[model samples]
Target: MLIFKNLGEMASLEYLYKYDMYFAIFQLTFIALLGYIILSWLFRMWKQYKQLKNDKASAELALLKSKIDPHFFFNTLNNLYGLAIKKSDEAPQVILKLSEIMRYTIYEGENETVLLKDEINYLEQYIEVHKIRYKKTVNITFTKVIEEENISVAPLLFIMLLENAFKHGVESLTNNAYINLELIVKKKTLIFSVENNFEVKENAQTGIGIENLKRRLQLIYPKKHELLIHKDTSVYKTQLTIQLK
Candidate 1:
């Protein structure tokens, strides 16, 4: 039986090697190899495209975060310097708060997302640091209504809005300026609002911080978020909403 099988295989090979069958064999092999090459190339191209898109997003996020972390820290340093110049007694407290803020900046800032409680604590630290720096009472308040526990959010997401509040709102007025922040968390929604009263400027343009925040939101949250801004002669308001699971 083995001898018969060997004889049949050889006969089939001999028929295939016949001169008249050469073109047919070549054509079949060519088509099969071409199909394989085309499939391989398409797969490679698809993989590269996916990789490139992911890398681009990662790099842009890193760049936006870099822009943010330094901007606020440097401004805080300036406040510290001001206190140092005046030899203010609260300088020590400010220094301690700033150190804690720096610790968060160095460690937690690198994470893609963090606990909602931790994020709120980070914001409070910023507020406390500024409160220590301010010479007069600026009337700052933070109100929250969260129905969820152990929520997670993108880190450093709201600091730019807070920074903008302080820069354009709190700093422009001589007195009677106020900054109000509100946070609401539902089962699948998060809303954060910042409102402040400021002296109107002659022709103030939007700053880089807000623009940076906008871009970051586009990258991180995409269609899952909303940023609303309203400004008038006396008040500037920003509300950000994110749909989270």
Candidate 2:
């Protein structure tokens, strides 16, 4: 009878061992499936994140380009209108300059980056257009010290600042108005500043140009740029520094 009980005990132990083995295999399979599901979910999320980032960047770039084009054209047309009304002798020259500006904007402005020299030439042309309009009444001085002419930068980066200087500073002033602009490049960094004198109007509006500029800088340069603006009773100053990649 004792031998029979021992045989039954052994048989029970063997059955338990087989059951544990099956359970272990099932647990391992479940764990592997869970891990695979988690990994697939993570991959999908990462792909979605990348797609959203790309879409946002494209949208911002398009919006920036649109804003720049309209702003520039409106200002230039306004200047042309003034010249046309006066029937000035420089009207033809202004038209030619406008054509050149339009051509530059059409070709180079669409580019993601343009040569610093080309951008400077565009600025010179823009300034020349305004100089003809303001004539000797407003004193405008532009100085550039470029250590590297082959440097490339975003197109129309400085035009807004220059436009603001003219719009708020010299445009409304009756006499003795002045605008000073300087661009300095040193050791992979570009420093630009614009200072102007203006009479404070009671209900003056600082337009959207500065905001647009700030957004563009944030997108393109991220942590590699600095912008400073100072205003007082008589003078308004803007300074921007960009670290080139």
Q: lDDT tens string, model 2, 1-245? A: 89989999999999999999999999999999999999999999999999999789878876886676355567778878888999978889989998988898778877889999998889899888878766558788889999876899998899889989988888768999999999999999999999999999988987888898999898888999999999999999999999998
- Would you list the C-alpha lDDT of every candidate in the order shown? 0.88, 0.88
By how many angstroms RMSD does model 1 differ from the true structure?
5.8
Ten residues in a row with the worst lDDT in model 2? 65-74
Best candidate, lDDT: 1
Name the runs in model 1 displaced over 4 angstroms: 1-33, 69-75, 82-88, 203-205
lDDT of 1 by residue, 142-239 (tens): 99999989999998888889988988888788899899999999878999999999987788755788888889899889999999999887998999
Steric clashes per prediction: 0, 0
